[model samples]
Each structure stands twice: as C-alpha cells, then as structure tokens.
Target: MKEYEQNQQKNKEHYEKVYANYNLNNILYWLNNLEGYLDFVTNYETSWSALYQNDFRNRIKGKKVLEMGCGDCNNAAIMAALGARVYANDIASTSGKIVEQLNGSFDFSHPIVFVEGDFLNNDLASGSFDFVIGKAFLHHLSLPVEREFLKETARLLKTDGEARFFEPAVNSKLLDELRWYIPIGNRPSKFRGEAFRKWKEEDPHPDRSFSSAHFKKAVNEFFEECLIKPVGTLDRFRNLIKNRKWNGRYAKWALKNEQKLPLFLNSKFARSQLIVGKLPLK
Candidate 1:
C-alpha cells in the first residue's frame, strides 16, 4: 500500500507537468473543424474509429459510459456527442478543465462529467455504468495493479456491461531486439530515450508494454468472454515512410489493410492490440 501510494503521487506529478503545457486551444480548433477532426482522429487515434466508432454510434446511444485516463477528453466528447452519458476521469486536474472547456464549446446532447482523481479510489458508484473504456491507460500500471484495476472495472460495471481498451503491445522479439540498437535521437518513432527517461524519473511505476499473451492472461482472469485483436502489423514500415511525400497515401493504405493481414503475422508483429471483454452473466 505504501508503494502504491508513492506511485500514485509520482504519476500525478508527472502528468501535472505533462498536461501543464498542453494546447487546449489547438485541440478546440480541431474539434470545431470537420476535416481537421477527422485528421486528428486518423493521425493520433485511428484505433478508435476502426474499432469502436460504429459500436459507439450504434449501441452506446442512451447508455452510461465511463472512460478512465481520458487525456484531453477527446473520446469522452465523442461519446457524449453519440448520446451516451459520459464520465471522464484522469489524475491530472488539467484534464477535467479541458473537458469542461470542451463542454462549453460544443452543444453535446449529454454533458460529460469530469472527475479528477486516482481512478481506483474515485467516488464513482459501482455497478452503474454500461460500458467502461480506456486507451493507453492500462499499460501505465504495473502487472499486479493492472490485475487489480481489471477486477475493479468488473466491480464498477453493470452485470450486463462490457469493457474495451486499446493498449500498446510487444509482439515481436526481433523488433524488440532491434530497438535497443537504435539511438534515442535517431529512432524512427516519436517516443525517444530522453522523453522516456524523463517520464521514468517522474513516475516510479513501470509503464511497460504488453504482448498478446500477457493481455489475454490478464483479461481472462477477470472476464469469461473476450476478444483480442492485434493491429498495425506494418506500422514500423509505415513509420519508415512517414515523412516522405507519399506518407499520406501510404498511411491510408496501411490503415485500410493492416488488420486484414493473417492473424499469426498480426499477433507476432503488430504494434498494438484492441481488447474487448464482458463480465460473465451470473
């Protein structure tokens, strides 16, 4: 418990520093423009559109939705627009303020309730929400805490409710080995050594990546039925071509076709996984 409390404080301070510099005005601009919104979704959160956009529009209408670690409240805003009563939670106070600002800017049918606190200890009522979702949230926890978090998620959901998440995955041993050889500045991806080191310095909890097997083990321990889909089999290749003139075309093609790749290939090499699970019907 002592370690957990320390970790919580560390995470809170880290995110406070991170969100202090966030660009709410820029995000608001994107939210106001249709093409820009689409671009933002495609570039930063493609999995949302690919995995849950249709379901959110179709099944989430008039349902109660809870989003943990809702950074910037983008997904929560979308859920509210789709007619779900949304509760968005994050450790950073800035996130709550940002959500409030978004609420003021947009005419959403249902207003989003923003809660700023540790999610595990928040004052939200249990067995009340119809759906629980998070993106890149679970990976921030240590394995034991992640298991506890999943159990808490079960406790918070309606008997018939469901949970979904989009998380980073470590699928390829070859790529993992190669990553060590790439220098921080020369690395192809945006998350480099300096930024990672800074994050670690602020937070004691291990924000580790997951493999398909790791995700499955954790989900199965809490839920009886689940589906895990690996995505972005060609993301490294796409990253290689990201800055070239044909980057847009290549990204479009990759996004369209990556999921269609064979299950084995995706499981071994995809950059992330989308996990969907439901509580066992008692």
Candidate 2:
C-alpha cells in the first residue's frame, strides 16, 4: 500500500508537469494546419461526439456525467455544451485550470466542474452520476489499477447508469509484430524525435495495449451487461496516403468503410475498442 501510494504520487506529478507544459495555441495551430491523416489522428474527441450524437444530445441531456481522467476536459466541454452537468476528474492540479480555459472558449449550456483528485479515491459521492465516460485512459493503467478503477466507477454510478470507454486494443498480431520491426526514425513527421524523447521521459505509465478478450473478461467481472464494439481494420493504412492531394477524402472513405465491415474482421484487426457496460439495477 505504501509503495502504491508513492507510485500514484509519481503519476500525479508527471501529469501535473504535462498539463503545465501543454500548449493550447500549438495544438490549435496543428489542428488547423494538419490536413488529412494528422487531422484524423488528433480529432478523436470530435469524432466521439459525432459517433454518439443520440446519447449526447438526447439520453444524457440534463444528466449528471462524470468523466474520469478527463485531461484537458475537451469531452467534458462537449457534454456540457449538450446540456449535461459534467464533473471532470483528473490527477493533475493544472487540469482544472485548463478546463476553465477551455470553458471560456465556448458558450456551454450546462455546468462543467473540474474535480482534481485520483478517481480511485476521490470524495465524490456514491450513486451520484448518471453516466461515466473515459477515452484513451484505461490502457495507461496496470491491470490491477484498471480493476480497482472500474470497481470505483461502479460504486459512484447510479444503479442504472452506464460506463463507457474508448481504449486502444492489441487486435492485430501481424501489426503488433510489424511494430517491433519499425525503427523509431521511420515514424511520421509530426512526431518529432525531441518531443517523443521528452514525452517518454515525463510519461509515468506507458501503453499496456489491452487485448479484446482480456478486456472483455475484466469488464465481465464487474458489470452485468457489457458490449464491446471493435471497429477499424487496416485503418493505419491511411497514413500511407499522406502525400496524396486527396488524402483527406481517402481517409474519410477508409473510416466510413472500416465501420461497415463485420465485427469478426474488426476483432481480428481493429486498432481500438469501444467498451460499454451497464450496472444491474438494485
């Protein structure tokens, strides 16, 4: 327990530094300039809002939403804009300030409160939230921590509320093997070597890339009803078309077609998984 506490503190400190150094201006510049492949890579929050339009605009309206590890709270901002009362939680103190800055940029219809603390041991009331969500957060945790975090999420959510997460999956054995062969210098131009080195130095938790089967097993242990959707096969191939003038159009077409493919194909080769689970009503 002592060692765990120390490690958590270290993780907290790392994130604090990350948020402190975060450049919103630089990010906006990249978003505006990165035409096709890079734009697709960086715009996940926008994609998520579009992907679950019905839920965001209707089902979760006027709902109490808790976003775990909400980083800069871009998703929380979206939820707030859609009329959900959002509680955005993160380990970094600077996260709240960033969220505040983000809130200032938009005319949000509902409240968004930034809660700074560990999600596993926060003072947030149990059975309080209508929906819980996270993106790109689960894979950063160790298996034990993931289990504990899910248990805590279950505890905090209302009996009928659902938890949703978008996480990276180790779906392709071939792609996984190929990753081992690709030299660091061969990476995309956007990933500068110095920036990559700095990120590696500051990142306390590296990607553990969960497999679909293992993640399903873990979720089943905590939730009664769970659905895991695997989407995107050969999705990374879009990167190859970066030099083409019609890269954005090709990337968009690839994305649309990838989602139409059968789940079996996606499960074998998809680069990510969207996991949704509901707690049984008492």
Candidate 3:
C-alpha cells in the first residue's frame, strides 16, 4: 500500500483501540451542563477555543455542518446539542456507536448522522453543507491525502460555506526540533535512537508538512478566502503547570493575549493553528 493508505489503516486500528471501551459519563455531564460546558471549553481549552472562534457557536445553529474525523464524537454531539444538522465521519466504527449512544441519551434538535469508512468514498451530495469542521484532525493525514480531502470539501460545501480546522502548527524548524527532545507520555525523546524510531513507526500521524504557509497555499486553489490563525503560542506552556485551576486560568489569558502579539511572532512560534477556508471554488 501507499504511504497515505498505510497511515489511514494505522489510524483506524489505533483509534479503534483507544476508544473501544470509552465511557460516556463525562460527555453526559457536559450535556447536562451544556451552556457551562460550552463556555468553559470555548474560553479556556486551546483546541476548542480555536475551532469555535469567530462566533462559530452562534452561526451553526440550524445549519448543515459536516465534521471530518469526528473521533469519540464529543464535538459532534456538542454541535448537535447546539442545534446544527450534524453529519460526522470517522474511520473507526466505534465512533458510530458513540454517536448512537449520544442520540439515544440526549434530545438534539437533529440527531447526528454518522458516516463510516473512508471519507473519499462517502456519497454525500455536492453543495449540501453550510459548514465543514475538523478539530485537531488534518495533521494526521499525509499531504497527498489532505489535498484530496480539501478537494472533496470544496465539492461538498456550498459556495458561501466555510471549513474550519484546528491543527498543530510546526512553523519554526528550531522549535519543532526542540519539541521532539522533550518526551510526552509514552513517546520517547528523539535522541532515544532505535526506541524513538520504533515508536514513530506505530504513531498514527503521518510525517507531513504542518506549516501554516503550506496550509494557506494548499487551500487557495479550492477556496477564494483562507485565513490562518495562530493559537497556543503561550498556552502551550500551560502543560508545565501542575495545578489544574491555575493551568486553566493561564490558558485563557495566554490564548487571548497571544492573538494580540504581532502576527509574525505568532506565525513563527505558535503551537497550534485554526485554518479557515471560505467561498468554495466549486
């Protein structure tokens, strides 16, 4: 198989194992306290804050929204709760079960439609959606696969539709190089030679370009407008804080202020990004 195909299969197996016995208690709690949950994540969580920026919460109500790579279906459930006509896709069949559980447990304005298997094979109609969203998802795909997905996004979206993806940003080679040396969780430091290589072999994320410049250029052909917003430049440091409350406070402050810095600084050093595409060429 080709590299992208191999990565896709790896991701399928990986996420299936990761979410196999997933509990819905946390999601249930959030559903019960929906407004409060939305307020907290949108204000303090880097990925959530970035993806929901520019009044996304308000705009999606009663709109057709497709979520690509909707792992665990938490965001899909949240969007459904917010009154969007949500369609979610994921390679893992386990995600479909999660969606089913959410629909059975909650009374959404419209139940989320789960699309399983490969994204490119979906029979979704053209110009059928008002919005397309993916949270921390694009970086998992190889560049060639990503281009195909973007082309599909253009075909599926209305002319005035928008695509929002919150993804990792690796704009500075120096910062990225240093990041690999500081191990997180099960992954060993890059200096670990064979150990690191073995871990990378199993890692689901494909080795691909993640620069904001590349993203901007890649989407330009499919969409008339592309905006790349840097996120977590300072919020990335919250990982160092041991106190949960303090970390949350710092993240909110950092995310808010990081945007105020000169664009050049944020573009070069931000830990994550929110890429927005509008006016689909199709």
Candidate 4:
C-alpha cells in the first residue's frame, strides 16, 4: 500500500470522523481553513447534490438503491417517495437518525432503511445494490484510497448496475485558495460562531483537497462508463453572491449575466463535478 493509503487506514477513526458522521463533520469542517470550507460546501450542494430531484431521484422509481454517505439522506427520502427500495448508510449515527426523522416526516408511507456503519469494513454482501451512490463521499479519499473504494464499489454494484459520485475539486489554484474563506452561510460563520469557544484547531491535511480532473481519472479506473460535469461550485459561488450578508446583490447580477468571466476560469471551473459510471458486465 502507498503511504497515504496506509496513513488513511491507520487513521480509521479519523476518516470515520471526517467522512462518516455528518453532525461532527459540521464541527470538523468548521475548523477547516476558510478556503477549504468554502470549496467543501460548494461541492456539497451543487456537485454531490446535483442529482437530488431531477437526475437520480427520478431514475430511482421502483428500483433498489444504496446510498453511500447517506448522512441526512434527503436524496434517499426522495427515492422512497418515488417508490424505490432505498437503503441508506453513513458512519454518522446522528445524521442517520436525522435522515430517519426526515424520512418519517415526509415519507411516513414509504419504506426506507437507514444504517450506520463503517462502510469499508461493513459486512454487506457483494453485489447488494442495483445502484450505489457516493454523493459527497469519495472526496474524503485520497487518490489511492479513491481507487480502492472504486474497486469496492465495483464489487458491490451489480453487473449492469451504476455507481454515481459527486465531490468538490481542488481544480483551480486560485479558486482552491479562495475556498478557505467561504462561510457556511446558513448560519453565522464557524470561526466567528460558537466554535470560537469550543475548540482551537485546523484541518490536518489541507493538501488533500481535490479537483474534477482527478476525480474523473479515479472513476475511469474502475467503472466502464463515466460522466462528470461541473455543477456545485457555481451554485456556492451563486450563494456567496446572493446571501444577504455577503455579496447577494453582486451574485444576482453576476448570475444574471454570468458570461462575463474569462475563458480559463469559466463557469465549469467554478462548479462542482458530477460523475456516473457502470461496472463492467463481466
């Protein structure tokens, strides 16, 4: 195993904390550098969530679904709403319960299962899901770890099944650097919020942040058909511009006339990347 893979495996609890639990993730994420936090949120809403209603949910009707990182599985709820047999998993029990409460609220009649476990070592049978989704999940993997997980996803996905993924890219140096400062925006800033009194810390590995090109390469290594597009970062940028306290007016104008940006840092670079691929039929 490469050093990073070893490092990741050695820090099993750490990865679980970072990628597994949604509630703690919020606190840990708030502790990340401002730019890193910004990029993370942008990717979460746009890239990972790109499939929310229009794309993945619509396709899930009458299907069996497994959602990786099903933390607060809003998408899973949607799938159940569409008559899917949805199975959602996450390392974060708190968020799993949140998904439960949420589904209960909106889907009292639909059937959905929410499980909490370390997916890498969880004893789920191979080829269990008709479709496997890792929305906002794989970005937590380094390149090598991503490869391992992709292989695992391939193992779990049925011969004709698909695995979809979404993650923020450390694509542009300029934008990546700017990500550290993007506040969570739904509430007060983490740094400026209650965390100021609870913990004094920062992300241990900032260099591991990712970009779409890298994610696309990882997907191609295992899945036969991969589609990746920039979708989230643009929305976050939209949020940054539109928030009442931030640059909302400017964001409205920029979005209204978004074509003014230059060629290199066009809208794509400013968005999150989405990918979908199928296991080889062998």
Highest TM-score among the candidates is held by which one? 3
Point out where model 3 deviates above 4 Å.
none
Model 2: lowest-lDDT 10 consecutive positions: 42-51
Candidate 4 at 143: error in angstroms? Answer: 3.1
Worst 10 residues of 4 by lDDT: 197-206
Each candidate's TM vs. the true structure? 0.85, 0.79, 0.96, 0.67
lDDT of 4 by residue, 66-183 (tens): 8887755655655565578888876666556666555545533456787666566667778777888777777655666677778878878788888877666556787664554456
**Whole-model Cα lDDT of every candidate shown, in order:** 0.75, 0.70, 0.92, 0.59
Ranking, TM-score, top scorer first: 3, 1, 2, 4
Of the two candidates 2 and 3, the one with more favorable lDDT, higher being better, is: 3
Colliding residue pairs in candidate 2: none
lDDT per residue, candidate 1, 121-233, as tens digits? 87877789898998878988887788888888888889889888888778887887675444434233224667655644654457565888888888888788888888767
Stretches of candidate 4 exceeding 4 Å from the true structure:
1-49, 99-110, 181-206, 232-236, 242-268
Model 4 residue 26 lDDT score: 42
The C-alpha local distance difference test score for the whole of candidate 4 amounts to 0.59
- For each candidate, C-alpha RMSD in Å? 3.4, 5.2, 1.3, 8.4
Sort every candidate by lDDT, greatest first. Answer: 3, 1, 2, 4
List candidate 2 stretches off by more than 4 Å.
Answer: 21-55, 103-105, 180-203, 206-209, 280-282
RMSD of 2: 5.2
